[model samples]
Target: MDKSNFRFDDKVVLVTGSAGGIGKTIATAFGKAGARVAICDINRVAAETCLKELRESGIEAMYFAVDLSKKGEPQRMVSDVVDAFGKLDILINNARAGERLELLEDTEENWDITMSVGLKASYFATQKAIPIMDSQGGGNIVNISSVSAHVISSGSAAYHVSKSGLSQLTKYLAVHAGPKNIRVNSVSPGLIVQDEHRNRFKSSDNVNYRTRAEQCHPLKRVGYSQEVADAALFLCSKAASFITGQEIIVDGGLIIQDQWALLSNKTHTTDNI
Candidate 1:
């Protein structure tokens, strides 16, 4: 592949929830790849830090602090980015919520918050960005989905459902936007460790928890934020001009293996030894 094909020079990219974790990585990657980056996050301090980092790296970047769960904030965010950059070429809906409640004990408030951030924000952001993109002759929209969309976990009911909706939303947007040359897609990631996870395992004994968790995956290691960022970049680049309405899963092959197969492999290894 030509390295120049991945460049985003002079292009404007807006990434939501980009203060830290996967969102931060995606925003930074775009900046480094020559795109004018717009970083949006609910946390002012973290957003400032990310913005500073991007600028110091000689990347054109700006920061916006907005609560995406609000009714008009998504549109407002898109407007702000366009106001700053003069044009929007790519939109990455990477923010998410609703990880604290279990299905049986879930509240309406929790569900609303989850759906608002994880799903609705993406919808309205794309709604607002489409015209701008169309005017610019076309653009890319990448929704950061989750493996939860396909595999169900015990506690995260709303989170899973919201992601499922996001995947479907990606397809719907693709169908509607294709005629206008606006491509819509998603990247679904699994078990990528971030700052919060690192903080939780800072203690000496708990530090090995990540290693233990990595063993469960076929790759024998967890994924990094950069991996997901790379996938997003590819989907948005001209390299994927023909691709739309699809999802690329970055799971280290964890979701493909069956419990029976894993157990059988372990049993066979023990017997062979």
Candidate 2:
């Protein structure tokens, strides 16, 4: 693994929902890799803060505040980034409406919010970026999907369905966009703890969610935002030049386990072999 392989010099990257959490980390990671990053989020304040931090770290960055859930906002966002940066080399569709509701209990507004930001926005943004990328020779896109798409949870109906659609969208775009030299793919993360939630999830309480989550993973631990970012960087780099329309699952090996075996092996240990 040559360290120079990850270098993204002269590239311009736009990351959606990059105010805080995983999106912020991904934006920063790209900046560190020598890419000029555009941090876009609905929250103006947080986005500004993130922009300051990136500039302070000597990473060339700018900020764009727009709600992707609104009509035409995604297209406008892509246009805005290109306007500022001259060209768009990479697009990371990391924004999503975080709502938790079951199908029976869900409202139309809630469902629409989730679908709008998670799936629709990504689609439109890519639509806008495709032509620009084709004109510039080529580009890359990484949809920030979730493991929820494959494994369902009780109260995450909209989230699951939206992610499922995103994965399918990735495939659809890959086939159509490939002829233009633009690559599209997705990274589905599982049980990732963002910076703000790390302290709370790490608490050593009687009912420990982290401990329980660790058992479900073969790696015996939950994942961090940086680990997921690394996977994304790889897919966008020349290392994955021949890859497209694929998904790299960063789930600590959770989705691959046999349900029956996991149930039987309740007691878990992480001793170094």
Candidate 3:
């Protein structure tokens, strides 16, 4: 494959919640593609560690440890990225907050946290980035959503609602941002297993959970952060210049199955949820 098609030289990228997991992977991918990256997350230690890793890999990167849940933080982070990189060309809204409670059991605090980080922060950050992107001609945005936005899962009521809102927000922003030459899209990952999950699956105790997850998808395997990163990278690349206001589902065909098949597959266990 001609790798040059995805080259992002001279571009500046800011990835929220890029301390670890899918966010970190996406940030690293963009950096490797020759873009200066700003790694933003609430976790100071993890953000610093991610920055160190990127530097070690010879990728230009900076770290910002700020809580997106707070008012003005999202806008401030965008400003900081612009100050550091001169201009921002790519924005990936990957930060997320969730509570594992059912709708009735969910609290106001939990709902606020979920919305603040998952949806509100992404919305405001994009709002701040639009003008900067417009001034520079154009830019790209990829919001990291989840399959939960489409499928109902037990518990995690706030998380589901936040993701659904995010997917819709992507469409809404794409329509308005399109006039400014900015492209907005989303990637919805399903059953992506990060470091902690890999470790858990290593133990004999959680083997059933892993097996059930694999069976839930047509690919017979759970996804990885890298897979989701690939989708995000593609959407941010010139390859997707004409694609906007759409969601690319990165699930292993998990969403295509009927509700009855999913329930029969024993994939709806609280553990998987």
Candidate 4:
């Protein structure tokens, strides 16, 4: 397909949690596609590094260091992006924070932190960006969700709940924003291991972690941040102009396999019966 269909020549895109990992990859993709990118994250140093990389690549980019977990911060971040870029064309809510705690073990503070950044931030950011987008006649919003929303994972109760809420929030916002020419959607990723994660598991004990993880997926490999970024870009591009209120799952078909199928090393043949 032609790459121009995905180009964002004069558009302004705001991506939260873009200091590193999938968020940074999304911002980088947008910057490469000609969009004026805004990188938002709690980590000032990492955000600055991403900002420098984008600028060095001849992409118009800025960085915002804000705690999305705090009330009013999401709105303030939107305001800052608009002030810097003159307009907001696309908003990617990709920042999230979570604690490793089961349902009974989860603390109120941890739950609040998870929901604040994962769900509440997306809601308020969309609320603040609506008017700006409406003024421009239209815009796009892509919430970064996770497979945890649909499939349960051990010790991730709060994170899963927040992601589920985010998915539903996408649908809700799409319904309200459709008439205003604004599109809302979500991209759910599974088992994406980025550079940081690789570093964390570099020891001999976990040297084969990636390989083992790949075996869980039908594709026989784990996903990359760029793959998720591509999905986000497509959802916001002209190619998906008619698409809204939906979710694109970028999981290498991990969620679709049956338990037995995932466990088996060999393919089954009906003729064997």
Candidate 5:
């Protein structure tokens, strides 16, 4: 099956924002399946922790502390990966910046930080990795965009714009890299129950925001990092070889449903990927 083909055996992957949530899950999956992964993040502690977990499971992993929002950080990180593994077969750009429901009031400082980390980082990171991939004759790049890229609400304006830019970046890379046999795609997850989101409501009396968000989704629930991870594995794997410049929506199918349907627990689940 396509799943099996996506096996990362002997492949070298570099995952950014891999400290927790979907990033960590994706890294673990690759590690479990046998891949040399360079786990990167702004927080070295978290990155090391993730690496330790992977090492405990016997996955060949490395950790690096890099601030993705910095201008040249992407290029530098790519260099680190190549130096560590001598080859980079996959690049997963999953680092994001946002605070839900705080877009309109967002400061310029916050906007720059969000956009740089979420969008620009992806661009330069992929740019740096492309040459390496070309030298190897081919490779894969899977970007972690979000449904927010398309369906925007009154929250995290920069986050939304950044993700939208990311989708376009994915398309551009796909078209440009096709000639070199490298495939580029993106995975857009819906409101998933990740640690960051959970942490947001830690002090709230009603700490069930995830549940509520999930309920609002057409699928009757939010998604897991693992689900999005699975989607990334698919796009990066040979299973989606013929697919490029395409984004796989990993949400609970929320984009299509109307507001009433979403609030009422009605869902449409006939999507066949």
Candidate 6:
């Protein structure tokens, strides 16, 4: 396939949560694709670091610090991207509340903040971005959902609920906006690992948590940040122009597999007899 098919030359992309981890990787991918990217995160320093990396690689990039949990912050984020680049072409909603490990003990405050930051931010950001897209004739949105949204996990109930809400929001926006040529979609990742995530999940050591997590994946490994970013870049580019309201799963086949390992049982023929 021609690499040009994936090129996003001159397009202005707004990517939220793009300081480090999955968000940073997605920003870099868009930059490499030739899109002018805005790296927005609550951490300005980290966002700027990502922007520097992109610039060093000869990509047009900028950085912004905005808290999505605040009202109007999303709109301002969109506005900053538009103001910098003159038009908005792609929107990647990649920010989420920190992973909640407790199922029942997670507070309602935590849940509300998660929704406000993740699901609510996407909605308001879209609200502010759609008009710009319409004025420019069309665009796309990629919501960063998680596989936990579809599959149940014993952990992080609030995070799971927020992602599920965002996933449905992806569909609703797609339905209403498709006629206007703005495409909306979700990319759900499972067990994506980066240095930061690895450190966060590390436990005192019979075996590293990563190895354990990797074993659970059908592919026998967790995915990289770049892998998820690649999926995001494709959905945002012309290559996926015909795609909308789709939930692209990048879970290393874990989503499809019934079990990660074959179960073994010992049976004694003499005992059975």
**Model 2 agreement with the true structure over 1-273: per-residue lDDT tens digits:** 777778999999999999999999999999999999999899999988899999999999999988999999999999999999999999999998866987778888898999999999999999999999999999999999999889987776888999999999999999999999999999999989997788888776734776778888888888999988999999999889999999999999988876786677754445523
Off by over 4 Å in 2: 265-273
Looking at model 6, report the run of 10 residues with the lowest lDDT sum.
260-269
In model 1, which runs have C-alpha deviations exceeding 4 angstroms?
195-204, 263-273
Q: Which parts of model 3 have CA positions greater than 4 angstroms off?
A: 261-273
Q: Which pairs of residues clash in candidate 2, taking residues 3 or more apart in a chain or in different chains?
A: none
**Candidate 3 weakest ten by summed lDDT:** 261-270
The residue-by-residue lDDT of candidate 1 on 157-267, one tens digit each, is 889988999999999999999999999999999988775466665567775786666777877778888999999999999899899999999989878866796777662
Candidate 6: stretches off by over 4 Å:
99-101, 195-208, 259-273
Candidate 6 residue pairs that clash: none
CA displacement after TM-score superposition, residue 170 of candidate 1 (Å): 0.7
Q: Report the C-alpha displacement of residue 55, candidate 3, in angstroms.
A: 0.6
Clashes of each: 0, 0, 0, 0, 1, 0
Error of 5 at 27 (Å): 0.6
Question: Which residue pairs come into collision in candidate 5?
Answer: 214-222
Q: What is candidate 1's local distance difference test score? A: 0.90
Model 5 residue 93 distance off true place after TM-score fit, in angstroms = 0.5
**lDDT of candidate 3 over 88-112, digit per residue (tens):** 9999999987677887788989989
Error of 4 at 207 (Å): 3.9
Distance (Å) between predicted and true CA of 260, model 5?
Answer: 5.2
- The candidate with the higher lDDT, 3 or 4, is 4
Error of 1 at 10 (Å): 0.6
Local accuracy of candidate 4 as per-residue lDDT tens digits, 1-273: 877889999999999999999999999999999999999999999888888888999999988889999999999999999998899999999999978798788898999899999999999999999999999999999999999999987876889999999999999999999999999999999989775676665567775876677767877778889999999999999999999999999999888877775457553334434
Q: Indicate the residue-level lDDT of 147 in model 2.
A: 93
